[model samples]
Target chain A: MAIQDIRNYTGQITQENPQIRIRLNEELHPRWAHCDMISRYLGHLTGTLDLEKLEKSEVAELGDSVNYVANELLENAIKERSGGSIEICSGAKGHTVTLVVSNRIEAAKSEKFKASLQKLFDGESSLEEKFFATMEHNEAHPEAKVSGLGFLTMMIHHGADLSWRFESGEPAHPGRVSVSARLTASVF
Target chain B: MNEGNHSTAGPETDPVVSGPEYLVRFSRATGTVTFGGTLRLNSYDEIKSMVRAAVEAIGPTGVLTLDVRQLKLLNSSGINLFAGVALSARSSGTKLRLMTSSEYSWQSKMLGTLRKLMPTIEGA
Candidate 1:
């Protein structure tokens, strides 16, 4: 069966002028379809293109990391937005790959998202501790599990840096949040 | 050449639903459990219970060789489950050795981290 296009937004992926860019409209594809495609494409490109400087294992790991990070951000964006579209953009400059996911959400949700960022910062010392803590917390209160493990995995496992923007709401709409992550490829 | 007793996991013998999600084979004679395919939340418990039982049956002196080279796509929760099994083996004085392939980097990265959970984890 064909995939259900729920979002109905246009998406584009371009690699021109020595840079790679992947832009997607949350309205175009399902939660993880876009991420899966981009990661697979990136993996293919790495295998067929100029990524010979990196080892075979590194290329595979990079693809998996990209897929996981993109999926995490996309899922968070969908949950944050009650009645708005999400825009996901990823670009590669040299060996650093950056991903940004943006959406509009309620003020309270924005506040909660920001608070989770602090927990990520605090747990930077031990990945295993953070993972188990998140698992246990999720086991106790399932609601708190949202985006917790995803953000932590991006930081601890993939060695990515995460930053966010929570813009206040306007007169008619809720606040807008944009979470970006910068991951330096561990190719060398 | 020589044999004690060997068992493989499948639809007939293994209780775990082994299909697209994951496949597990336990060898009682050799104390080896091999895992394959993706391990997700749905089939997590099946694999864990199988491993746990296999570890216990192997006894204290036997070495439990967990070969996860073909097992791909383990989510965070699945990794946590694996950590539990590895640590249980450690505490029970059952030697746990992990066999992994060099092709999949996620396995190496995650399994390497799991080593810290069980300091004596071999071939991680």
Candidate 2:
């Protein structure tokens, strides 16, 4: 699915009201490529995306952070379903942010997929784990065209927290495997 | 020779000027041209120009050794540029070898992938 179509799910409010909400819905398989594209698309759609709109150093930091988180989130989706679609609902309240990136995983792929997400989260909890994870590949998505680093970049470097829910029955609101994240500005 | 006939020499791999590598007259005798420097997104444009120039001068029958010892990082955009170089060599039937020390960032890993994607040259 296209990001534009996904936007219909969350009803975006990029215009700095009290929060920033972005919804991305897409299919599986291209795991890394989709995350990279959607991330960039949101980056463009939100033009100067951030509460403060960022300066030189801050913008650089933001880009790297988002890239990492993107990798983590994408890997989480691709571990299961070969052709399942994903929907990511992202929202930010002040310095705190939330992104829900979910995909349409089948019953057969649900368990393994959830396990992968949990594993990624446990690894991300520690600094060393996050560091190593960023450099390594997701064994699950072995045939992937690109190195899987989008989610790691976002979480490890960008201050985003990863979370997801895989529901196989009734496929939940048609077709979408949802994976989401919550990001907050760094304290320092 | 025929000034690079289409049936002969393929899509151009940019040429590497020698002045930057110490005025070593870049003639048909050079055989292979090696570059040493950064390969960030910004430097990719200059590198491409140099590569195409080198490939053109090196001709289809010759070989080019890309010394990546100095190339530390490459952004996604830079990766595409590098891929194009490899593709050009493949389509044109020229030989391109990339040599890098162990100190490559995650970006450089894309080089290995590019090499794998195209079986024409070598080293992925």
Candidate 3:
């Protein structure tokens, strides 16, 4: 909410730089549209391109497409990038679409989940196999299910074709799992 | 080696494709299709059949209620099917009440956005 207030303030500061204000606003709230709901407000803040000027219909489609792709990557990222909470970063922007899902997994936990997660992302194993294996692992502990397909629309159907990946220890010293994708009118 | 083509798809992904587990009639006066078990992608086909059957059973003159409380997850395909059905019902002059959380802010928001995007779609 504070971030939204900042955008309003920025617009009031300089009418000549409304575009700048829009850019600032985009950075705080990244594009996220999934099944009529945005899982993350993104607090995207701003971007180089000006999507703020786009119509809601256009934004809705772009948001849906962006979300579809992001969710698929996250499915695998959760298993591979274990040990920390996953969060969508607020600093992503694009006229087409943008998503940055970040997960924080402590380094102290087991990395065994990493290999299985990689297999799923790589397509060596099916989602079903991964789910069973993950479920077995979850039998001992609960709430781990959040890491798998919690918000699916963003991952599998982003834009047109789907893509995903995983990374750790970025920006901060703590481990992080991140996945992102985009879609343009020409590409779809 | 393969489990053959007979393998049932996971019901978790697409609710539209999944088949219904059963059909229960609360009353002949007012028919309701209650989605039991897990309503996932793999189960949608059956569910669709059930929906059609329930609607037909109730006939054009009767009303229907879709209870989604037990629904595990309603995916994109499921939502589309719902929109399609709701539109069809509207044109047919049949009333369908969503016996669900209209007051639930998130669900309402979701439904409202969906209705806006798909103008033909309608519901309670």
Candidate 4:
């Protein structure tokens, strides 16, 4: 099969040096509770950042944002994983905190994920409009499988920069995708 | 108001629903549904059902106030659940209000977005 790679970036530009990396094995069948635990841990770690300029309340807010972003990313990864390990990396530089999560998915799902993301990144609607539309859609159709609210919340509510990279055709790992979210320390 | 824990009862009886990390209790006397603790459920099914039941109990022409000041963390799924509840209340001509705290920025911001979506959903 031919190799395929797709990338999309949005929001502020920042370089990342992931200081912490964790991998969750699919064999263990991690539960949803694990996502909450990991996200809380990340939030605690974020709170400890030595950004002296940030006020105590600002630091707390940043930590909460990190926790929310991490939980959403990890939840999506775990829920959509296709028999491979999920990797999470988190770090901070200056006022920006970066979190990246990579997981293996079925090759076929990559297109669907990319399309959903395109709607988020390239659609003509403003983020707020798209968010409300998505919420209304979900409300009207309770049985819809995908809500598409996670990324929107990360961007609109938390003020996080979001990006994604999808690759396929590797011999050992056919479908691998990574999503990165960068958050500024300042409270929104 | 009826503060005791009650199962999914009819419109007259107060319902107190508990999840792994959260509890949602509706006080019929006050027309308020108080959500306390973190709510990061993997899927929206559980929270959706609980919220739907509570809203249904409110019935048409009734006021439904969501007191989320105590809710610490509500994931995107949970946010979506509230959005659905708000729309439902609007369609049924039920008055909806959200009570939030500034301490939890996410809660306030999420509720603010919902308020913007549905202008009738008052926020305090």
Candidate 5:
């Protein structure tokens, strides 16, 4: 396959200036627990921002959203990656908090991912409908592995602006996929 | 896993499924399954059997109330599991009631989605 660099953006495009970047390599065999720990840590770190003016509930909500988004992104990376390190970058600029997670995936899987994204971005069904439909389908089919609900939850419930970058056709690393989720600070 | 039976007047003991970060307790007397702590299991399969067992314990009659007020976090896999449980309860002609905490904004949204899946489900 020829080298292909595909970028798809949804919602709003913001500047790429991340405040914190954490990389987890597959070689170290990162456990599932790490996802929870890292997400909680990020939540605590993000919760401290603008703490004086915000209500306690608002602060908690902000932390929860950050934690949830970060965990979902990290979990997806760990589950889908074929190999290589997973890089996660998070930062807040103005009213938006951006989280980008990148990992190496199999070329074949990238095609499937693209198709899924098409459904998310281009399909006639609203995101709410698609989310419930996906859940119903998964329930009907017990053997089906992927629910595709994580992305939907982030988009529909958390109001996350999501985008993707797929890079392939490289000699050293063939397939790399990066997912960025931008959440408005006030949405929480 | 530590099992703690709820102190209730019944011959049947309540079922408690617990991990380091999470606890799921099903009280037979009240027909309520209370979930607490964070549930971010890597796969739905990890939680499938436990949740299914709770449903089975609920039997085929009366309403099943899932109290998640104390639940701190429920990942997508956990959502899927709960969705499946809701579907099962609906198909079995059992009323389902979800009690969620307003402290977590996501709970309301999640309840809305579950209601869409099974409109008969009651959210409190």
Candidate 6:
């Protein structure tokens, strides 16, 4: 769905509010091309928002962080979804831009994803260290594409706060995951 | 973005994996490579191989300058790939320099961290 339509669902927030959401159903099956389009659109939108609210000097950094975080979140959602749609949301509160990307995943993979997130929280290794470790691991196993570095990048490289929520399966919806990331960028 | 354009003439895999998301150009004479477009996890191996090859080509006491003003989006894996390249260059006694533009917010933010990782490297 278009971002404008999602905005309607989100209700009428003040223009000063930096948050916005875009949702796509499974029928869209947004391929990589679609992902590129959506990312670019959000990047531009977020960049404009930042420019309007923050100093001109901070625009580049803000734009880059939101775009990078949004793209990675969308990529993961599409990769994990078995057969469902995805939702992407973004907004700024104070000096941080909060972004959320969610989708329905396979029941089997939810545990694995959850375990990885837990590792991020409990593991002693730093985000930078974990990033390198994953890089090395990926070399030996070339087939693996999801190296679990998306959240780390947001946290360490891009200076973004990250979180996730996995909803329990219900009669209507099963295996839903919402991944959220927040970055310290003044949009208001 | 052209796929399968990696040249095998260098010591390692071609560092410039030009694809739909991004384009990489290496100037052998200037020891510089320019990157443009989106870089994701799938491009990680190709980039690593390319950096390795570049370092080997430059050898010890050589310099490799990276121009990333045009590279719009780079995922975490791509960041890791560049880190690997920087570390590899540092260990091999090669100097790495990055040229970035203030016009692009991501480059200014990211390249700064990368320069910190490779302290010996230069550029904004």
Query: Judged by lDDT, which candidate is best?
Result: 4
lDDT of 6 at A77: 75
Fnat computed for model 3: 0.03
For every candidate in turn, the CA RMSD to the true structure comes to 8.9, 12.5, 15.6, 4.2, 4.2, 6.2
State which candidate, 2 or 5, has the greater DockQ: 5
* Overall lDDT per candidate, in order of appearance: 0.62, 0.46, 0.40, 0.79, 0.77, 0.68
Q: Residue by residue across A1-188, what tens digits does model 5's lDDT show?
A: 44343344653322255677888887677657778888888888875543335556666776788899999988888888877788887776655667788888887788888887777767588888788888889889988877788998998888888888777745456588888888765634
TM-score of 1: 0.68
DockQ metric, candidate 2: 0.05
Write one digit per residue (lDDT tens) for candidate 3, span A106-176.
44431443454355566567544553344334333433323343223333323332232323453445464
The interface root mean square deviation of candidate 2 comes to 11.8
What DockQ does each candidate score versus the true complex, computed on alpha carbons?
Answer: 0.17, 0.05, 0.06, 0.52, 0.51, 0.41
Residue-level lDDT tens digits of model 1 in B23-103: 678876567888886553322445556788888888788788988899766555556666677767777899888899876
What is the C-alpha lDDT profile of model 2 across A10-104, one tens digit per residue?
Answer: 43322234233433334223543455456545433332444554455444444444444544555456554446455444444544445555555
Give the winner by lDDT: 1 or 2: 1
Preferred candidate (TM-score higher): 1 or 3: 1
- lDDT of model 2 at position B64: 64
Position A78, candidate 4: lDDT: 75
Stretches of candidate 2 exceeding 4 Å from the true structure: A1-34, A45-56, A71-85, A120-153, A170-176, B1-124
Which residue ranges in model 4 land beyond 4 Å of their true spot? A1-17, A50-52, A170-172, B1-13
Predicted candidate 4: interface RMSD?
4.8
Which regions of candidate 3 deviate over 4 angstroms?
A: A1-49, A52-56, A65-87, A90-95, A108-113, A123-155, A160-174, A183-188, B1-30, B33-124
| Between candidates 2 and 5, the TM-score winner | 5
Model 1, runs deviating above 4 Å: A1-38, A45-61, A75-86, A103-106, A123-148, A168-176, B1-12, B19-21, B25-30, B40-46, B56-61
Error of 3 at A122 (Å): 3.9
For model 5, the chain A TM-score is 0.85
- Give candidate 2's error at residue A10 in angstroms: 18
lDDT of 6 by residue, B1-124 (tens): 2244454445453445666567776778788888887776444666666767777888888888888888766766677667667777777889888888876665665666666667787875
DockQ-better candidate, 3 vs 6 = 6
Which pairs of residues have clashing backbones in candidate 4? Answer: none
DockQ for model 5 equals 0.51
What's the distance in Å from true for residue A93, model 6?
3.8
